[model samples]
Target: MKIIKYLLNSTCLLLIFSINPIRAQVTIGSDIEPRNGTILDIKQNSNTGHNPNAEGGLGLPRVRLVNPNTLTIDSDTEKSKYIGVTVYNTGNAGVPEGLYFWDGNTWRLSVSVSSYGNDGQFLKSDGKGSFDWSTFVMPDYKYHRPTQISVLKSANVKPESYSYQRLTDGGTGSFGGATPSAAFEYLYSDELNILSETANEKYLFIGIAATTRTKTINNNVPRTSYWQIVGIDIDLTDKNGLNVRTLQKNQRLYKTAGGSDLRSYVDLFTIVPITGVGKGSYTLKIKVYNVENTFSRNTGSEGGNFVTTETRFYDINLVDINFILYEDD
Candidate 1:
């Protein structure tokens, strides 16, 4: 009876060992244990430079274990093969070196981007995860000033100059207030085609400006006059189709004082710097709204010749918007 019991007990122990049952606590290593859900675990006793990575140091792969694995070089086809592999892009003749990973469609990277702020603001480091946002005084670039811009000959036409013109005053009186003159539409846009070799929106549209002098002319209806900038408009276009920026309220230009106009001749043309110019063919033009007339205390109006004579040749400048050079990246 004792012999038979020993045989049965031994057989049961063998079966239990053969059919191993599953357990959740999968621990390894003699000293350390698994924390949780660890399918595989490894332990190293000492540190040594067993294998050097591409950097010639005992550094691990640029990224952790990735699906499909990294290829040694950049391959447009390999990207499709791997589908979801990540690798340190070892730059070649035409390729750039960077940390990138493949998704289903394209390789993505953690690219650094530019930060911007108001003129008086700058960047600061917090010695932590993020940069502290603020402003700093930039050293004056006191770089050489660029050469004066030359207006293209194509835009220097005569007939197209006075477009969208309309005298809204009902003679015998003068008035003020913006006339929603659809006149902007009448201005010739042929000059708009090529004021520059560059794209349209890239050019800054400083409105037309010229110095002027007032005189009590010997005429039946005597008056004095001056000039001021009015307003501007902008537009843009791209893959999405044509887009138009509706004109904003006209900006009023005020005289700060000084200067006498030379009779019989208009002052040299100047550019009245525009504030908010953007992308597209701006095709800037000057429109004199109110022709100022201070009468000789007696005559209420200056003959129409005053309006025609003064604004003879003041056209705005079209400077390229190359602000990207100074932009923070």
Candidate 2:
């Protein structure tokens, strides 16, 4: 009877143990069970009920590393197991103090610290995975002058044949007339060459100064002469035939009327800024166009009584032409 009783108690205890399975999880600072799939859970004590102002933190082990490239672990087998290990480094032996991690072969700095750079210096990436402090560099300014100058003048023809009438009983006429003829001519041009060594992403600043002189003759009837720079174009072309033209039109130079043997001179100055230029062999060209109006008119009833005017372009001189290159922002 005593043996049966002892066996019955043992069987009952075994049944109770089998019904409630044992867990390998651990929970600290609280009596609650550890979360599912978690081997260890740590939190602040909740003895005084849940407190919103609870303060708790986990601190990593601090160490002083002599060199980040070399690991101090003597056992190669043990070092392999510390590939993902991380620690806070307290500066020592020239190594900066920061968070570092073992990257299988060496320890690498995990954070960029301001203490690594001096004042007014910036941390720059090496395009790889490394960074270093670098000093700021200012933009450089370069100057270039025109190498060649040329002009394309109008054909030596009568003033009445080349020029047109500006005002009459009819109405206001077009500046260049019906079609672009000798009346509108390419007066002047300046060329500048940019070599490959000086080609870069920059701003091309162009400064031009030109002077023009004109002569007009007035008969018995009222006669007038008008001549001006109708257009200014900058043609930039590369070796591969990439062309870009920046043009300004109707830039007046001179205008006068109703005087015999009348001579007039005018000066023109302009500055053009061209941005976003790329690296290449480029030809910088400036083209200036001349437009004039000196047509003859018949005022009297007879055809012989014709009022004819003669106008001529004495000179179109380029006083100064300069090109400057500035680094683009």
For lDDT, the strongest prediction is: 2
lDDT, model 2, position 327? 46
- How good is model 2 by TM-score? 0.34
- Per-candidate TM-score against the hidden true structure: 0.25, 0.34
Best candidate, TM-score: 2
Query: What tens digits encode model 2's per-residue C-alpha lDDT throughout 1-329?
Result: 99999999999999999999776898776777766766876765533436542367668888887676666644545677788888888877566677889987788877574467789998887553346789999887664443323332223111222223332222244323233234533333334444324343344566555554333222322344444443456667666656754646346544454444332333344444444454445656554444443333444443322233323323344444555554432
- Evaluated at residue 278, the lDDT of candidate 1 is 34
Residue-level lDDT of model 1, residues 58-105, one tens digit each, is 232454322223443454456567665666654443334455666755
lDDT minimum window of 10 residues, candidate 2: 153-162
lDDT of each: 0.36, 0.51
Model 1 RMSD in Å is: 20.0
